[model samples]
Target: MAHYRASESKREQFRRYLEKAGVMDGLTNVLVALYEATEKPNDALDFIKQHLGPGADSTDAEGSRVELSELQHKYDLLLEENKELKNRLLQYEPAADHRGVE
Candidate 1:
């Protein structure tokens, strides 16, 4: 009984390690895909489809949803800043435009 328990514990540990490794591999693959997409999105999609199994599309979709949400938030902030800069530019334009007349 003691020997069997010891063997079983070792097996469980090995399985856990394997599972962790697999997750790590998946994450690495995802990062690589993102990098590839940055350069060539269609190629990246093809690579994901070839390498990431049938569920790859769903996984990529979820990842894209998250990225899009973040990008939208950033874009809103940038648009606000752009508006502020344009207002500032307009303020300067009136003074500069009047300088020659004065």
Candidate 2:
């Protein structure tokens, strides 16, 4: 049918576009790597993201995650320290009711 042919043409064109852009090859390589892994990753999507996303290194991604967590913990500690310092400083300040207009 004419409609079937048109659909097939569009599909073929899209396929060629993917090939031209190397998307097919890149995806194929990623899939092959996944297939060849000795032990399957617990989270396949995360594995795909690590291999296919920017920087494309699982160790780098993991290191970044660890660094982020450490920095977050440091930030929390700093916040608590800041709050304590502010409270200590307030102890020496005059009460609000003591202020008078000059």
Q: Go through the candidates in order and give the C-alpha RMSD of each one to the true structure.
A: 12.3, 4.9
The sequence of per-residue lDDT tens digits that candidate 2 reaches over residues 1-102 is: 999999999999999999999989989989899999999999988878877899787688899999999999999999999999989988998777997878
Model 1's alpha-carbon lDDT is: 0.79
In model 1, pairs of residues that clash are none
Which model scores highest in TM-score? 2
What's model 1's lDDT at 27?
57
Q: Report, for every candidate in turn, its global Cα lDDT versus the true structure.
A: 0.79, 0.92
Question: What is the Å distance of residue 32 in model 1 from its true position?
Answer: 29
Query: Top model by lDDT, which number?
Result: 2
- What lDDT, from 0 to 1, does candidate 2 have? 0.92
